[model samples]
Target: MNDQRLRLDLAALADEVTAVDLRDRTLRTSRRLGIQRAVATSAAALVLIAAATGTAFAIRPDQTAPPLPADTPSVTATPTPNQSPTPTPSTSADDPSGAPPSGGSGTNTPSVQFGKLFYGPADVTRVKTAILRSWRPGGSTVQLLALPDIAFKGNMSVSSDGHRVAWVDSNNNLVVADADGSGKQQIRSNVDPYCVGAAWSPDRRQLLFRELAEPGGPGRFGMLDLRSAEMTVRWWASEPAACNAVWSADGRTIALTTDYGVTLYGADGTKKRVVPGFSRDGWSTDDVVSLAPNGSRVALLRRNMGGGDAGDVARDLRVNVVLDTRTGKQVTLPLGGRTLRQVYFQTDGSMVVRVQAGSGYAVLLVDEDGKKISETAEPASLKDMQILAVVD
Candidate 1:
């Protein structure tokens, strides 16, 4: 919501935009060409035109960091997988014996201080509840109400301002609401409840979501124009296929991973760039990408082989790799010994990855140079935590 304006010269990239492969893609040709004009605007400040819905607000070049809610917590990160961590007894500022602190006595109280954090809470359960934690604000913990009747299927995305969240409800309805758990609205209904992907644009003006008609059924990708109430389909798979939809941090690009490599698309659903390398691996319930804030780099979690029991599958599986989407350059993270589950990008140009540790999951902050910074406290359930947002 920053009023700051960034003027970009789109004329230089106009040729590249037009040269993108638009041959046999699923997006409509007329619509795609129209979007190219809007994105490659010759005006002073590049504009976004949502056709018929009018123009979305001029997107500021710099993304604003999400705000810290009153209940944010301070956190202590655990060590790497090889290190044997010594159990540190919990202590309070008022007491030296590491005994329980007074004041709250079971009630939730706001922490006095906080730090920069990347948050990912536990998954929603049948009890409609999950535990929320902070990576930096010094380890405050709270229980958040999971949306009614839905276990979080794939990912729950928090907008840039940290005020709104978008997820799929148990009914397969795309739900948007305030972060404080108010103003719950189901934007899309009567679709498949097995929704897989949900993400918010950097400006928080739109959302990208995908769902299937049923298990192993056809997949549909749609963009919800928050300001104009327009739902546009970017692509609809003819047969059953895995869809991994990722919106760039700059709010201008979207990447969809099919059995092939990643297909890059414009904000208006036009095909932009296609960088092929990803395997035609089997469809995973957790197919995703962690795009850098500047839209330069991306981290992908490649699924290895596993079957039979769930525990056995989780034990020996998966590898994460960071790739420069433009040059096809990649750097593999040193997470070979652990089961890497999820990956995300922090605003500081670092990577926030969630890895399976023991019976739970730990959030690791990795720098842009691909060095491990620290690992936060492990959550009770590995299935619960997915990096939601990063606050600096």
Candidate 2:
């Protein structure tokens, strides 16, 4: 009932009933990327911590705060429906190497196709501060800025064009800045500290995050429009037991992982369909649901919690399941028998999938139909690195 008691009980329950996915843990602990790792290891903790810390200012139906006034410059306009949603690189006067800026241009520069990967140290507990870095897959990593450790715990997000990044800081303030860590702006201060996820809208003008309606309460979803600096709360008619939100590439639909399954909603927040049996109840995490670019399908990491035997746990958790959002049918992936660790959808409908190799993992670019396009070259050591955003 109490937060401490609940955390202890959940830890005990985890030890008794949950199987630890060693590969998943290794990837998460080493790379410190993906929300699934958090869901797998700390879902219960996140819920309890949120409920505990947010009770004092939990949102009430009648007491919702008025939208904060816009203080920062408006975000770039959303791309037209006919235009590509991928980001073009901006000219940076700060960096001569052509690397992304740490504090250079805003969003006003001319657009050209730009590709970069943003990632950083996964474990910042010891250091207190986390350093974010940007690098091409095979190129040198550039140090961006040092941020609070909380910024990386399912709270950090990179824009579709890989030009911007957003995260929640230690004080529960939502901050947005450029990919190289420049032009920092604090959008929302004192947001629910336990909100475990943040996602960039496809057009890159807004962000999606989880909100709690009350202290120690159920979950609600909200969107922050950078262009207007206004917050919109959706799913107000009902509360999900637990959830995480993601946007479709077209910016037309939003998908949420819930205790019941994955639910789809239009941009206007109207429920479209419910893909049941993919709930986050037993073994789902915040990073499990990734919507396709076209908003027709969703990729889910459905962990196969092994039998009662402890020895069987690691092997069972490597399974993955993707579904057709329209039909709620399971779709098979052409993985060539490699265990799928995680899957992320790109703006073009293709996916970058992480699969288990002998002691590490491999990244593959795959087509919409599940055909492998090519394998990406990663750095020699991924020990504390995580791929935050990708633009091809």
Best by lDDT: 2
Best by TM-score: 2
**Residue-level error in angstroms, candidate 1, position 296:** 3.1
Q: Ten consecutive residues with minimal summed lDDT in candidate 1?
A: 308-317
Score candidate 2 by TM-score against the native.
0.63
TM-score for each prediction?
Answer: 0.55, 0.63
lDDT of 2 by residue, 1-392 (tens): 67999999888888877555677555544332222222234665655443322211000001011221121111221222122222323322222344322211123212211235555554443555667666553344556666655565446676766667777665557788875567889887645444434567767666766553444333455667778735544434544443445666666666765443567776556776776554433433233346665566677655432322221111111227777776667767766687876566655556666666566555666656666655544444554565555544
Model 1 C-alpha lDDT versus the unseen true structure: 0.45
Q: What is the C-alpha lDDT of each candidate?
A: 0.45, 0.51
The list of candidate 2 runs beyond 4 A from truth reads 1-115, 122-125, 138-140, 211-220, 229-242, 279-286, 305-319
Compared with the true structure, what per-residue lDDT tens digits does model 1 show for residues 52-88? 1111111111144442221122112211221111111
Candidate 2 lDDT: 0.51
